[model samples]
Target: MGINDDASAGQAPHADALAAGNVLNALPPGYRLQEYSLDGVLGYGGFGITYLATDHNLKCNLAIKEYLPSDQAVRDGTFSLRPKSPGAAEIFHWGLSRFIEEARALATFNHPHIVRVLRFFESNNTAYMVMELIGGQPFGEWVKRKRPLSEADLLAVVRPILDGLAMIHASGFVHRDIKPGNIHMRTDTDPCLLDFGAARKLVSGKGGELTAIVTPGYAALEQYHSHGHQGPWTDLYSLAAVMYGVITGQRPIEAPARARNDPLPKAVAVGDRAIYSEVLLRAIDWGLAPAEEERPRSVQAFLQALPRADLMQPSSLPPATVRADSHSGFGTLDTALTTQLEAALARHLGPMASVLVRRHSKEHTTLGPLRAALANDIESETSRRTFLERTEGLLRGESPSRPPTTVPGSRAPVSRPPTAPPTTVPPMFDPQFLAAVEAELANHLGPLAAVLVRKSAAKARDRAELFLLLSDHIANTDQRRAFIRKSVAAFKDKG
Candidate 1:
């Protein structure tokens, strides 16, 4: 769990040590674990203790979660962990393996909204997982401070979480715990999903019959049973509960209780209409369904329930001062063009792409300027360039390539001259040639190949020049050389 500055709430550096029932249990400040030095306790729970640590090699602060399992194990005199009883040893070791598994699984994901696990290793007869230390407040604390948030403001936080959670589900894991406390609000106001201690992998799309590890209001009814059929919907239910708390300023009725009498009020009935849209409220209600089968099966279904317009209405909320320049001159966008631009931008920006495009589209009506404005939002020069190249056709309001005029002696096809306008010229390569090159490059660079091919094509005057330019994007020397050979051979076959 990431207990940020605001979440600690004025606790002394060693507060968590006391909270965990033993000061001696926590590694004292300046205790070294390889390159990291334990500074103090960040927070501790039944499963483990998180420490504020300094990475001597990196010269930065990070959080290290130690698999303490306070109920089964305790710190010995020599600062090493040992099981309390002979029977507890099996349970403690099993839990340690699961904790390490959690670290490995989370480390594979690089999503902005997921807490990053840097590394994990065993030390002092226990395992430790090093994680990026977030510098803001817990979602629960942040919500208290920024209460009365508008629909747009609330969705801004909710959307990123859904994005991260969707990734976790797609990868076959359920974050059994999705309470506000597990959601970290970064200094930049971005939300990150944290505390994967309760996360478990699903087998054949269903979670195994394990012990019920759940938060009261957030957990779905399925999570309340040891042999319950838990899946993605389980996480959605918890996420919806968090939203319910944000909207109603109170936690919804617990699942076990709801399953019996079902007295919990619908979000649509309780949420203030003036502050929140009916569609948004209804989505929350649907997500909070007592029965897992009754709730939205996946994140996509839940997202569809709350349409984009309902979530991005600027009029009902305060003006986005940071985006004031792009929020003016609101105009309607062509449906096809809008979808195309959103898909292209989504490749670079992930789930937040649509939100950004919608905000910018309100100002620019034309594709060229709209693309330029969106490109500026991309922080990376490489990504921005790739986005511009990928959408070059959209900028010109036409297909990326046209029919090629083949040269008589050379294999390389010459560009056809435009018949409609003297100033316009066809692309240097045909659509088939570009697609072939993109396909070949995809073997090395994945989806980024298409954008790189388009960028190289714009600069290359001939087939040889095009292959040479495309090779620059590939870092591996052998692979780059191999790509050039394959590309040239493919061009010959095409000719």
Candidate 2:
């Protein structure tokens, strides 16, 4: 709360209130008009005006946003007075509800990367919220001055944006409108995501269709066209697009031009000057997919699918509590039934070709050409399957030892690693590793294949890619999220 002493209380109302038609200065008789001295009017949107103000109560400089009921439709050239539609009044009511929700939604933000709401009050036709004023320039401006930010700088700023989005999603909200203009960076280059969160909370609590949606460039197609189908993926899509713009100067579009077939829009090959790696470039492509069902299902899944080098580094996998043991009726089958069951699975999953490879070596050691090719594919597939199986076993292990890692002069047997230190160290992001893990996870967990493709795998937010990969193996949605919530809480606890 950046409220200065003189700004909070004991100040004369604006003398120009009458001239400006400041409907709020005479806010009800007993309730006085609060004057927060305006240092600068930052910007105005269709919804309301935002000003930089000094607050006395909080004794700090703050950004005060007064959300006035939007009369934007009249000015936007969309709605008309000619004829009332089936739900004209209903639409108006819904829009008003959304506006309120947006205000309340703003109030819910408590992250360091987000602007904090110090106080919220209603007067006349608007809602006034006092928030922390971040000293930063718009991302658009940063791009203008700094041009392509260094990869490290990109992460310093972008990571927090992902974090803020995840935080918003965990609270059951979506920042459907994600774009460069919506991102702000402090003078220090610490990026703060702004105006990215959606304002749908004021609508029906049970969730209803939105009449209007976010802007086109960064907005997910589903957000606008799909009726009442809003979910975490919508925001995931938009965020991926923002990342795309950050990495590649081009505004990422969803339509694929076909270097590779990805669900989201792939970053156009901008060559060396491109700010992101191929993994990130590919991740962006996945997130910008045209359809909701075609996108990653959750933010976590989106994180996992991101391209990252950390995927190759030995990292602690999420807790492995849910297991195949959860499936009941695991009695040992008769030997006859065991053979039949194995045969069935073999036919279904494509036989463990290693068995054939072994049999081949024994049966025809001298076989050439056709037999060699058959055995070669079988050997390769077998190796991949074996690696995937070992990983699955490691993931299911009950012990919390260190994850298996290839190290110099380490004689100990390869076993799953212990859980990471519970300190609040931020993650080391690697886009390439993220992509590889996603490819591996998709291979290991077949039934939950869609999880790998969740959100914008093809869009390239490495952290989102990691989460997507994790989501694929986890059993229960509630449980998977609970793990992430606990992890964040663990860090917050340390902090």
Using lDDT as the measure, the top candidate is 1
* Least well predicted 10-residue stretch by lDDT in candidate 2: 1-10
**After superposition, which runs of candidate 1 have C-alpha atoms over 4 Å from their true positions?**
1-24, 205-207, 309-311, 316-364, 367-495
Q: Please, what is the whole-model Cα lDDT of each candidate in the order they appear?
A: 0.69, 0.46
Measured against the true structure, the TM-scores of the candidates, in listed sequence, are: 0.62, 0.52
Highest TM-score scorer: 1
For candidate 2, the lDDT comes to 0.46
Query: Clash pairs of candidate 1?
Result: none
Q: Name the regions of candidate 2 deviating beyond 4 angstroms.
A: 1-33, 37-40, 56-59, 69-93, 105-108, 187-189, 202-207, 225-228, 253-265, 268-275, 309-440, 443-495
lDDT of 1: 0.69
Candidate 2 lDDT, 13-55, residue by residue in tens: 1221122123322122122227566554544444445555666
